[model samples]
Target: MATSRIRERSPKRDSLDDLELPEDYVPYVPLAKRRAQKYQKLIHKKAGLDFGSNYEDGSGSGYDSNDNYRRKNKDQNDSGRDADEDDDEDKQPLTGPQAGISLIEQSVELRKAQLSAEEQKTDVQKAMEEEAKILAAVAERKQLASAEEISKGIVYKDPIKTTWTPPRHIRAMSEEELAATRLKYHIDADGEDMPPVIKAFRDMKFPKPVLDYLKNKGIKMPTPIQMQGLPVALSGRDMIGIAFTGSGKTLSFTLPLVMRALEEETKMPLAKGEGPIGMIVCPSRELARQTYEGFVGIADMLHKGGFAQLKVLLCMGGINMQEQASVFHGGLHIVVATPGRLQDMLNKKKFNLDLCTYMCMDEADRMLDMGFEEEVRTILSYFKHQRQTILYSATMPKKIQDFARSALVKPVTVNVGRAGAANLDVIQEVEYVKQEAKIVYLLECLQKTPPPVLIFAENKNDVDDIQEYLLLKGVETVAIHGSKTQEEREYAINAFKSYQKDVLVATDVASKGLDFAEIHHVILFDMPKEIEDYVHRIGRTGRSGKTGIATTFINMNSSEQILLDLKHLLKEAKQKVPPVLEALEDPMEKYREMGAAGGCGYCGGLGHRVTECPKLEQQQKTKNSGMSRPSERAGNEM
Candidate 1:
């Protein structure tokens, strides 16, 4: 294990001078020392190129081998030279060209390596971020899917059971629960035990003016609809009352409203031009005007001694705002306004509804159907939440039901007949014909009816054409549509109601509770697009349990869905469908076979001879899975 290594070689080394040490006695050294030794040896080996500055005495005399040898020995002894050190000296520095080449190559290579390393690091980070985002999105989607499933768990069942079942749970209950289940009989049928409220009304005799007005109208006793509705309304109860057109619902709510307004006027006598005492919002302009007339009749009686000049204003769209504002400015004790123009004027700082304690929505369901829901909500939100809200309509559908449920607080539901069903007094008849023959059939029906008739069309253009056709046939007729100005519409409505014109051709705008008392027939010139509308249209006739006729002009190739709806409605009304019309089967089948349902071939569904599709002819594509769609089913099973 003994070894000897020479430190520096001299020109003369005499004989062998061997040196040995034990392998176990070797000592460890730091890496710093080892690296420095390596660098020094590299520099020394090129000493000829490194040592150019240190010359003796500033003379350019290079040292000889002897002097160099002496200098090396002196430095080694002073520095305690180890045996492992190298012995080259006089190394030289690199030349300018070589140094530049080396620097450029080193810099370029270093930059390339650094950039590659940074790019790799960035890529790894981006991949991690993307993976995290994907996982988060997946988690969110799963949560939404689960929430949808949970929400769809709700089930619907009929509240009034058709089939009977016995109760299985007969166990005894706690006394508190048993007491809670007991029914309270607050309503008494005995007229002898009338409530103090009813007694007070009976005791308070009507003024001479009011009695005279009632006597003129020949209204001796209040109808049942009036009896039930008037008491509750006068008591300031929120009520939803439904009665036939002739059931005197107008008087039911109107009487109480007039009484409230009259009493308020007597007690407070609103400032010369202040807010209305009561606001009655009806669905249509004509209806609103009619309601105002009804209010005037009642107010004339109620306001005999106090506030004899009961100012009632009609605010509805189509009428000039300036005219309405003039009336509103003159001081309105009562207002009968359609929702739109009333809200419009109110928005423009026209009138204040804060003083309106009694609010009644006549034909409330129709108001909702005609897209007046948000407007109604906006109007109601302005009043105090505790205001007496009375909603009157001929029918209440699910939409109206939901709206009432939210808008009214613990409202009393009153229906004069069936829910969402029309009057039984109105006769319903359907005439099945080809689509092209519908116009001819309508003319024939008109010819058969000698009395004043109201024809209901589905669209504005149809109303115009029907009116023109009737006029050309020497029939006295007038048309009312939304396109007409308020003045023209008002004039037309007045003409129809006053019998200046025998027939009024109209759209659904005229359908909502416009009581043209003389209208003994309602001819459905075209089937309504929505089944719900049938109720409102037919309801225009058959006012106050009076017998009336409703004729539906159904084409052999009309919508089967509409026919089905008509059949169902007639069945509910307990009217028998004529066997002739009922034998047509699917209405759309004939139209489909003739390829007209696929469209006119030239005009598609536009029903025109032109080859181009008009701007309005483009209808939205519908999903094809239901019976409502006219297209064929995928499985032929339906």
Candidate 2:
């Protein structure tokens, strides 16, 4: 083998000269030479220099021989730098010949100048400039009247007036007395020149008809939310009202909205297709319909009091779009609509918000939770002039606050209790039941309370299954979900409300903003994924100061975080916490002992830190993944 290796050692071959090649094969050019040729051609084309014979022959020597090209293009590469330096001294645009240039050429030059100027700026300078641009845009928008406002004869220059005056007795109260009233009601008001809390319905200066309606409805006293929220809303100030559910939040905004509409109608009779001075945006169709009915009742009262009939329309999905559109032609004084259907109508030119200056977002937190934030913004854009916006919610999470900051200007914040706190009027009961045994245990739990019970499940399928199981067991039951037709949902709701059905099984769609009368019991078939939902679910009972009971079933499948939150909520409300929940370790125990901030500031959920908030994390993931699909959890109530 050694002798064979030493036989012959040929010199290393150079290039392809040592190999036999095909006769038709063209010699390969070196990569550097090929790149040089391409660059030479590009330079010649940009400089408007002709490619001489040398370049045509593939030598690429034409660029060096052109003395005139070199002389003319010597400083062309530095032109942008020179222009940027000149701009630092003088910010004026070029005039004379430059001004006479074609639009295309001028645009190019302007873009170039902008790019050059931007390149020379530091990060701080760029930030300042961007902020200045945004402020200027906002100022410009504020100064200009929208086309809709102009068409409605609204002048942008006129300032919004606070026409609601407190009654003589209320005005006679000293400042200390007013503060004491707020303190007594646990009312916390924050803003510049906050309105004083109203002590009674009489202090709100409601029209006699409204006062009579309240008396007839047996609303003899103002709830805590009404005590503070009514004054803030009636004062024509944008407001964020946070109070526990069933704290009269609906009346706080609805009464003011109706009053404002009545005032506008008195000033100028509504012509066909020319009204809706007040608009209320709700998250679910059921809530929208309920609100519409409430509006109609108030409108009837106003008509009976010798005022023009206030035409109210319910705009929501499932109803015939044509039917809703037909009502718009008769002139609507107030509209209660779900965000999706309202935006659809506005997009179809079925209606406009030109005259709508009073806007209320009921269950504002739920609207945001249902992925209607963008749709809400789109609806707001349709408003022609500044509106007095009122956002009412049982919870004021950071997301809602951020939305408020963007939507309202100089808004007063009214909180009747700590945001997201459960209702003390509800007697909470927690039970441990295996997942497979939940159905059997559900019937047993129903015996704890009487008829007119509300049962909440987390999913639509569960709702249907529960309803069927109850019906099979000889229990009168009704069900509603997003899958139900509009007529079916309405009938089910009315039947339940009228006591035709002893039990109502539903998803989260019915959990929010639906006021059921005399609901003696609320049962959660399974623990909710979020603690906020649990609060709203139990809120079905214990409405309007009536004490009620809420029973929740939890098993191994329930998340520890949710269990921890449930435990804390029970403790906060002085309800009994189950031993199963008490035995679970708190992940934040050490952090709390270290005096670190407790719970999530973003959502007020006691189970997790802000960084570990599931809602926030899911939102971030959705944003990062560029997801555009609406959440299915919003249910069929859209």
lDDT of 2 by residue, 221-266 (tens): 8988898888888888888989998888899989988888888778
Worst 10 residues of 2 by lDDT: 137-146
Candidate 1 lDDT, tens digit per residue, 87-155?
322122332223324667878988999988768764435444454454343223111111223345422
User: What's the TM for model 2?
Assistant: 0.74
List candidate 2 stretches off by more than 4 Å: 1-159, 324-326, 628-634
lDDT for 255 (candidate 2): 94
